[model samples]
Target: MIRSAYSHPVAEVEITELSAVPLNVVELLSKAHHPKAGAVVLFSGEVRNNNNGKEVAYLDYEAHQIMAAKMIRTILDDANKKWPLNIAIAQHRTGKVTVGETAVVVITASAHRSEAYQANQYIIDRIKHEALIWKCEYFTDGSHQWGGNCSCH
Candidate 1:
């Protein structure tokens, strides 16, 4: 959505069509890189084996896909406003995600390291806080819990 040519050297909002397919962090990182950019920061969120004290079997993610994409774009826009980023991308997965599989990936590119790193973190944090995506964790012992309802902080 950033109209400025300099603001958006590369920008994308992606929601995986095949839930079984893993997030490709390398591809996102490559897309974020630009000749003018000195720094490219990437973040990948993966499904862990355990949450709290429970042993997680797999994660089920759900979202109003259209709304989630909109929210992600908005978060990217906010990052653009706060930083001098040349490129930004944020992606998330839906349906079942098993342990060790990537659930989300975010990338940011800028002329400086500070802005790239800061904006990358900001984008992911905002997505977690504001995006409509929800996750349900299925434990190995036949227990389940809503992930969005809980926060680390």
Candidate 2:
């Protein structure tokens, strides 16, 4: 079953969500802000107009809702262990997402830009590589293919 938003209290991570609706960048960024943070990095993974030379119509994402949310929390926790982050938040969409729309977002705030940037990248990379999410790419010709979110596997 598709789940809306899921969030639970973690020691370092504030939010881990697998949402069915569109992600709000401004709201997430605001939540990542901290008095001690000197930098907050945001990564929005948008659905592009084309992929592998095919004209894309849109994307449909599916995930093992509970498993995916737990995986994201684990990823955030790992990032927290590796960086001195004040806050971290991750949200991923799990439904029809049109071209140019955000499919996933990761925000990290730290006392330095270096840490924030590193942690943000780490979180997204791990999610793309490890999350239990699947993506089906719809082409303009009405063909589609289901696969993992990344090419790592």
What is each predicted model's overall lDDT from 0 to 1? 0.78, 0.82
lDDT over C-alpha atoms for residue 23 of model 1: 77
Model 1 over residues 1-153: C-alpha lDDT tens digits? 323333445444343422336777787666665788899888888999988888999999988877887788778878888898888877888889999988988888889999999999999888887788888999999989987335643
The estimated TM-scores of all candidates read: 0.86, 0.89
Residue-by-residue lDDT tens digits, candidate 2, 69-148:
88988888787778877778899999999999999999888888999999999999999889998899999998998862
Candidate of highest TM-score: 2
Candidate 2 runs further than 4 Å off: 1-16
* CA lDDT for candidate 2: 0.82
Error of 1 at 21 (Å): 3.3
- Evaluate model 2: give its TM-score: 0.89
What pairs collide in candidate 2? none
